[model samples]
Target: MEFRCKKAGDECYGVKELTLLSEISQRLIQTKELKNDLSVILELLVRHLDAERSFLTIFNRQNSKIYIEAAYGYSSAQQARGKYDLGEGIIGRVIELARPIVVDKISESNLFLNRTQQELKSKDGKDLTFVCVPIIEESQVTGALGLLRLYNPYITKDENLYLLSVIGSLISRVVSSKQEQMEELEALRQKNQELQSKLDDGQRPVNIVGNSGKMRDVYSLVNMVAETNSTVLIRGESGIGKELIADAIHYSSKRARNNFVKVNCSALPDSLIESELFGHEKGAFTGADSRRKGRFELADGGTIFLDEIGDIPLSTQVKILRILQQREFERLGGTETIKVDVRIVAATNRNLEEAIEKGEFREDLFYRINVFPLYIPSLRERRDDIPLLVDHFIEKFNKRNGTSVKRITTSALNMLMIYSWPGNIRELENCIERACILTTDDVIHSYNLPPSLQTADSSNTQARGGLMYTVEQVEKQLIREALTSTKGNIAKAAELLSVTERMLGTRVKKYEIEAWRFKV
Candidate 1:
C-alpha cells in the first residue's frame, strides 16, 4: 500500500496524487458554506495523507484569537474547545511564527496542548507526528492547519510539510474571500440601520420623510431656528413642503403651546387681504358685520404662518411691512392702532426677486420678512427620499382607507425614483393615495401608478427629436439653458436655478458640461 511514486528521480506528484488534488480543488471552489467547505477540505487532506486527524483554526482579527472553524473527526463540543491565543500552544505558535512545524513525537513536544482531547498515538503505541502550517494571505498569516499521523518511514517529513503548505495556500484565499463578503454585508446592514434611524427622526415633527443630504441640511436649519423669535421665510417650488416647514418652525419654537394662526394670502382677495391680516372694525366693510380679530391679532403671543406671501397685493404688503417694523397697525377704517406680539413664519413658492424686478412685490417688505430664509429642496433634488416618502404615504393611506397595503413593487419604485417630481412631496403623497385606492392587493404594482408617471420619460423623448433621454438629461438641458442665459456666470445661473453656486458647480461637473461654452 505505497502512496509514493516508484519512478526514479521523480519529485512531482504521481497520477493518484494529481487526481486527488484536482478533485479536492474543484469541490472547494464549488462549495458555498465556509465551514462546510473547510470541513470537506480537512477530511480529504487527512485521508490522502494518511493522517489520524486534521483541523482548521481561523483567526479573529477583532479579538486577536484563533478558533477552530472545522475539524475532520472532532465532535462539536471538542471543536468549540479548540480556541487559542497567539503562541499559547503548538497550533497557535505555528500562526504566530508564520511557519511550518513537524514534530516526530507529540509527547516529546512541550507545545502540544491537545486541547480537543483527540487520540494522539497510533494503534501500535508508536509516536504520532504532528504537522502544522500557517495559512497566509497577502503576506500575512491569517490562520493555521494542523495534522496528526503515525510516524511512517514511507513518507518524508519534507514531503508532508510541502503538501500541507500547498493546502494552506488554497485555504487562505477561501478564508480571505469569505471574510471580505461578511464585512461588506455587515457594512450594508449598518448603513440600513442608520438610514432607518434618520427616517424615524424625520417622522417626529411635521412628518418630513427624508434621509438625503439636502434634507439633512433642511433639518439642521429647522433645529437652529426653531427656538428663536426671528421671522423665517420658507422658500421653494410649489408642493415642496414649504408649509410643513413653517409648521415645524412654529411647533418647535418657544410659543408651541400658543396659537398657530394660518393665513392664505392668495386665497384672500385684494379688497380683503388687508382686512384679513389686520382686523376691521364693525361696519368697516360690506361683509364685516362685527369686529373681527385678524390673523395677526389672533396669533398674538404665538406665531402666524403666512402662506403664499407672494400673492398678496402691493397695498397689503405695505401694511404687513408696517406691522413687521413697528408691531402696530390700524385695521381697515379703524381709528385705534392695535399692537400684537407675534412671530411670523412666511412661505411662498414664487421667486420674490423676480417679482420685485417686475414691480409685483415690494423690496422693503421682502427684506423685513427675509430675516432667516430657509430653502426647502424640491423632490427632484432629493430623489433618495422618494422611497421613504412612498413608504410613509402608503402607510398613511392604508390607515386612512382602512386597507392593508404593505409595499410597492420593484418596478413601481424604480419608476418613482426616476421620475422628475415637478410637483414635489405633495404630488407624491397624492399619487400614493390614488394607488392605494386603486390597488386591491397588498403590493402596488407598476400598472397601479398614474399614466403621467408611466409615460413621463417617453414624453420627454418625444420632445427631444425622438431620442430617448433620462431624467439627468432633462436636468442637464435645463442647466445648459440657464448657463446660456447667464452667459456662463455660475452665480447668476445658480440664482436662476434656485440653487447655490457650489451645488450648480457639482452638477456641471457630474454632467461633464462645459459652462464656458455657453459664454458669449
Candidate 2:
C-alpha cells in the first residue's frame, strides 16, 4: 500500500492505485455478468484498500428501499440485514445527498448505524474508518458503495474518500447497464401480457380448471407464447401441473395437428437416454436390434416435451443444446446429421440455476430452452382454486368409477382448504378420488378424507378439542344426516343411524336438534 502524494491541482491516483484501477477495469470488461463480476470487483477493492469489509448497495426505485447487492467479507445473513430506506443510515444518506461521506473513525461517529452488527475495531487496538460514495448514473443517484478499514493517523480521510469515489464511478457503469437490460426485458414481458390479455379476454385454458390470480397469470403466459415456435421452460414443484402447462402450450400452437412427443428424462437410465432421445442405428449398442426413430425425429414439425429436464446427463446436454440452436443432431453411432424442426418444451422441478453453479447442469442448454419461461404456481399458493379443482376431479372420478356422488359437504371442503397440498394438485386429486370411493351417501364427509388431512396443523380441528371431541362432532353430524333422511321421524332416524331410540333421543336432546324442520 504505497502512494505518491496528491497532486497540487488534480485528484489523481498514485502508480499502485493506478495499477489497481486498471486491473479492476479489465475484470469488469471481461465479464458482463453483473452479480458475479460485482463480487469480484468488491473483493479487489477490499484487498487493494486493505479494508475489513466492503459493500455495493442498489436502490430499487420501485420499492424505495436500498439493499446490499454484493459484499466482501460479509456473511449472507449480514448482507440481508444491510438494508436501509432513504435518509436512514450511512449508505442511504450517501445516496440521498449524492455525495461522498468519510468518517475518520467509526467508533467516534454517531452517524455510523452499524446495521450489519460488525465490530468497529481492527485486530489491533485501532478504530475503523468508514467511507461511502454515491453511485450516480445519468444524473440520478442509483446506489452507494462503502468501505471499512482500520484507521490510521498517517492517512487522510480525503484520500480514502477520493479512492472510493473513483471506484464508485466504475461500478455505476456496470449497475446502470444491468438495470437497463432488466428494464428492456420487463417492457417486453409487459407488452406480451397486454397482448395476451386482449386476445384471451378472460378466457381460461379449455383443459385446465382454475380462476385464481396466479393461475390467470399462468394462462396469460401460456396464451402469449403458444402461437410461436419459441422453446418453453416450465418450472415448478413436482405434481404442480407442469406437464399440463406443456400440454396447453403444445395443443394451442400451430403444430397441434402434428405429433407431440414426450420424454421423461428422469425415468430413463443414463445409458438409454441418448438412444431414447436421438434414436440409434441398427446394432449401435448391445440392445440395439433395429433402427429406431428418436423423439426429436418423431416430433418433426411439432413440439417435443422433455419432462424432468434437470436430470439429463451432461454429455446429452450438448446434443440438446445443438438441437435447440441448429435443429439438427446425428443418431447415436451414425455420422450423418439429421435435420428436424421441433419446438422444445422442457419441465423441471429441480433448481436448474443451482445445478449450473454446482456443475451438474449446462448453462448453455438452460439459456437455449428458457426463451419463454412459465412458472406454475404451487397448489398451496393458489388455495382459492382448490374447490374448483376439487369439483373437476370429483366429476372426473365419478364418471370413471360409475358413482353418482354429488358434492362434498362443507366440513370436508373446509379440511381440504386448510390442509397444505404439499404434493400439489396431484395429491388433491388422489385424496378426492379416495373420498369419492369411500363415500356411502351422495355427499362426501370430512371423515371420508384421508387420516393425513385430519392432523392439527392441516385442519386445526384439534384446537376445538382432542380426539374424543372430534369423534363426538362427527357422531352428531351423522345423527343429523340420518334424521334429515328420515324426514324427522325419530324411530326411522334411530333405525337409519343404527342406534336405539332411547340412546338417539338422549343425544338429540344433548345436541338441541330441531327435528321438525326436516319434515316433508
Candidate 3:
C-alpha cells in the first residue's frame, strides 16, 4: 500500500509537471504579459486537483502585504483578499515552513494555527479536506496555494497521495518559470544599460543627456576620446550638463581608477588663473608660501577638466597654449621645467573659432583642443527626452527626499511637455526637487505645479477668448501661453507646461517661432 501511495504521488506530480511545462511554453510565447495568464492557470489547477475552493495568495515582500491574485470555485464578490499574518493561518504555516501541508480532516488537525479567533471560526457548512502548499521559487516562498472542498472528500476515488504531490509540484514549476522569465527580461534590461553606459567615457563631462541619435554620437565620441590621451573640446549651451559628460568620459575609460581634476578657467581671478592651472613655487608671489600641485600635476596619468575655457584672458591663453604644445611648464619663481602627461577636456558656451577669428583666442590653441570635438544639442534639440527626463527626475528626487511620489498626473505631464527648456536638465532637476519638497499628495496634479506654469490657462483664455482655433493656432497659442506663463526659459517652460524640451522645441520649430533659438 505504501508503494502504491508513493507511485500515485509521483504520477500526480508528473501530471502537474506537464501542465506547468505547457503553461511555461505559453507564457514564454506571450512575452511580458504575465498576470492575466496566472489566473486561468490557477483555476484549472484547482479543478484538476479536485479541490472545491482554491486561492493563489502572493506575498508582496516589498510592502509586507498579501494579495490573492487568482481563485477557483469562489465568487468574486466573496472578498478573496483574506488577510494572513506572515506566520498565522494554515496557509501561513505552509509559507512559514516553506513546504506543503496535506490534511485528511481540518477539524482534528492542529493546522488552522493562527492566533486569531477570526481564522479559527470555520465558514458555515464548509467542512472539507484541506491541502495547503507553499509556492517556492529561487529558494523563496513567494506565496501559498490551497484548496477546500465543501461537501465532499478531497482525495479522488483513487485515494492517491502521489497525485496530490504531483499537482503541487506542477504549480511550483509554473511559479518558477514565471520568475525565471522575469529574471531573464531583467538581465536583458541590464545589458542594454551597459551598452548605454559605454558612452560618457572621456574628457570634459559631456553636455548631452539621453540616448537619441545626436546624444549617442556624443557618447561614442566621448568613448573614442577616452581611449587615448587627446585634447577634447565640448561645445554646448549653459546648464546642458557639460560637466556630467566630462565626468562620464574620464570615469568610464582605462584611467577610471585615477584622479580627475577640474578647473573653471572663468571662475578664477585673472591674476591667479595661470598659476592656479600650472602651479606656483613657494614665494612665487604674495600667497605662494607652500609648494602646491596644479590641476595638471594632480591629473598626471589621468584627465583634467577646463570649464568655460572661452573666458580665459589672452595672457592666460598664451600659457595654456604652451602647456598644450610643449607638454611642459615652469612654475612661477622656479627655473625648473616640469613635464606632465595629462588628458585635457575643455568646455565652452562661446564660439571659440569666432574668438580666434577676432584674435582674442590663439588659432593654434583652438585647433589643439579641437582634436576631438563634441557639440551637444541644446534643450530645444532633443525635446523627446523631456518626458523620460521628467520621470527620471521624479524617481531621483523621490529617493532624495525619501518620499513615495508615485506618479504625476497626465495633465501635469502634458503641461511640462509643451514648454521649452532653455536651462536644460539643471532647471528640470530643480523644478522636480521643488515639487518633491512641496507636493502633499502621492501624485503631483497639474494644480500642484509652480505658479509660472499655472498661468498658461489664463494666458490662453485671454488670447483666444474661447474660440475654437485651428491646429496651428491652438499649437502656437498653447506653446505661447506655456512660454509666457513660465517665462522664456525653456527648461522652466517645459517643467511648468509638464512637457519635454524636445517636444516643446519641435512645436516652436514647426510654427517657426523665432524667439527661442538655442544658444550655448
Candidate 4:
C-alpha cells in the first residue's frame, strides 16, 4: 500500500511508513493499558523499519534521568539495563539537545556510547545505522525514541529521520497524557490518606466517659476544631467534665507532642493573676522571687487551659485581650515584648453573657475566646449515662482502694438515679468512693450509701405514700403530666418518662385516659 503525505511535504509512497503509522494509531486508540500499547507499537516499528532493535525511553522529571520504558528484540534483563543520565549516551544526547541524530556507522561517531551493550552488527558483517529523535512536547524535549537498523543504500538518511520524527511526536502526546493522569490519581490518593489519618487521631482513646448523643456531638466538635489553632471556650456547670473536653481537644490536635499547661483562673489572687499568666521578672513584687515563666510562655507551641475564665479580674482581662489579639505580651516588670504561639482553650461555669451585660467581663475578650464554643451537658440532662458512670466509678474505686466491690445493688442504683446529681460527676465519684469504703460485702446495698442519700430516699418514700393516693393513681398523674408536656405525642411522652412507647400505652390503657384530649 502507498499513501500521499501532506505534512511530510514529500508526496511519499512507502508501504513500511504507511503501515507503521496506521497500526500505531489504531492500537493506541483500542488499548487501555499504556504500557502494553507502547510495547506493541515498538515491536511493530522494529519489524516494519527492518531494524535490528528499537526502544522508547521516558524522562523522569523527579530524578532528571531517562530509562528504557519498552523495547523489541531485547530480553527483559537487557531492557532493564538501559538507564541514562541526561547527555550521557546517544539517546540522552538527542534529548538534551532537543534534536535528532543519525550515525551512518555506529563505530565512526563518538556520541555512540553503547550504554545498553546491545548488538550493533548486521548479519552481512557491515556496520549498522543508529537513529535517535527527541520526543518534543510544547517545544521542550521530554524523552527520546531510537532504533538500530542495517545500512540501506536505497533509503536516504533524511527520509528515515523524517519518518522517525513524526512517530516521536505521536508518542510524546500519549506519554504526556498518561503521566498527567497518573499524577492526578496519586494526588487524590494522598489526600484521602491524610483525611483518614485525621479521623483516626480523633477516635483515639481519651479518658472521658459516656456515649450519649450529647457527648457524641461534643466529640464531633472536638474533632472538627482539633486541627486548627483556634481559641476554644468550653461552657458548662462545674464538675460537668469541661476540663476533660479541654484535654481531649489538646491531645487530639496537631500539637499533641508539645506541652499542655493548665491554670485555675479563680484560684489565683487578683494581685498575682497578671504575673501568673504573663510571667514575672525578678524583683517585680515585694516577694522579689526569681523570674518565672507563666502559663502562656510555658505552653508555647502547644495549648493552655484556663479554668474559670470568668473569675479573672477586670485589669487582667485587658491583658488577656491583648495577648489574644496580638499573640505578644510582656512580663510584669520587663520591657521585652514576648511573642508566643500558644493555643488557648478556656473553660468557665459562670455565665459570661450575664457577666458581659453587667460589665464584669470584657466583651472583646469573650468574643475572642468564644471562636469555638463546646457546651458539655449536665448529668441531669444525660440521665441515661448515669449507670455507665456508676460502673466506671465502681471499677475505678475497686482498683484504687484494693476493694473487691463487684457492683451496686438495684435499690442503690435506683436511689442514685432518682436523686438529682447537683454536684455532677465529681460529686457522684466521691459518693461512690465513700460507699465503697463503708460497705462490708462485695455488693453495695442501699443502706451502705451515704447518710444524705439514705435520708433523701426515706423522704421520697414517705412523700410518695403520705399523699393519700394509691400507686396507680400516682402513675396516672405522672403519665398525664408527661402527655401534657409533650402535647399528647406518645413517642415524646414515653421519652420524657424514660419508658418505651408500648409501656406508656399500657399505662394509659390501665388508667382509661384519653391521650388526644391533652393536645391543644
Best by lDDT: 2
Using all chains and alpha carbons, the TM-scores for the candidates as numbered come to 0.57, 0.51, 0.50, 0.52
Q: For candidate 4, lDDT tens digit of each residue in 1-520? A: 7654542324443856898899988887787888778888888988777688888887766445577878888888677667676776688788888878888889677778675666668766778888899888888676788888887666688987998898987778877765465456656765675665466445643688775556767788888898899999999999998888888999989999999999999999999888889999999888958998888999999999999999999999998899899999999999999999999999999999999999999999999999999899988666556767888999999898889999887678766655566678997899888889989988888988776676655334332334443345447657866887887766678879997655787788876665755655
Model 4 clashing residue pairs (backbone): none
**lDDT values, one for every candidate:** 0.80, 0.82, 0.66, 0.80
> For every candidate structure, what is the RMSD over all alpha carbons to the true structure, in angstroms?
18.3, 23.4, 17.1, 25.7
- Candidate 4 clash total? 0
Model 3: how far residue 297 lies from native, Å: 0.9
Give the per-residue lDDT of model 3 (tens digit) for 1-520. Answer: 4333332243564565467557645654665555566666656656554445666776655334344656665566443335454665677677778867667666667766421122222366455666767777667877777666432443452333344445445566565555455556656765665554453333224443475456667777777777777788889999888888888878867877888999988889988887888888998899788987777888888889999999999988887888899888887678889888778899999988889889889888898889888898876566555666777888888777789988776577665654455566786777677777778887878777766555645333222223333334546646755665554555456666787555666677776653332211
Candidate 1: tens digits of C-alpha lDDT, residues 1-520: 7454543123434554565578778987787777778888888877665568888887766445577877887898778768676776888788889988998889787778777776768766878888889989999877888888777656678877887888787778887765565456656765675666566476446556776667777887898899899999999999988878888888888999999999988999888788888989999978789998888999999999999999999878888898899899887779998889999999999999999999999999999999999998888777756777898998888788889999887678877766777777888898899898888788899899988788885444123223344656557756866896887766678879997655787899987665655555
Q: Comparing candidate 2 with candidate 4, which one achieves the higher lDDT?
A: 2
lDDT by residue (tens digit), candidate 2, 57-85: 88766435577888998999779777676
Error of 3 at 505 (Å): 21
| Candidate 3: regions farther than 4 A off | 1-209, 454-520
Best by TM-score: 1
TM-score of 4: 0.52
Q: Candidate 1, which ten residues in sequence have the lowest lDDT sum?
A: 458-467
Instruction: Give me the displacement of residue 202 in model 2, in angstroms.
Output: 5.5
Between candidates 1 and 2, the one scoring higher on lDDT is 2
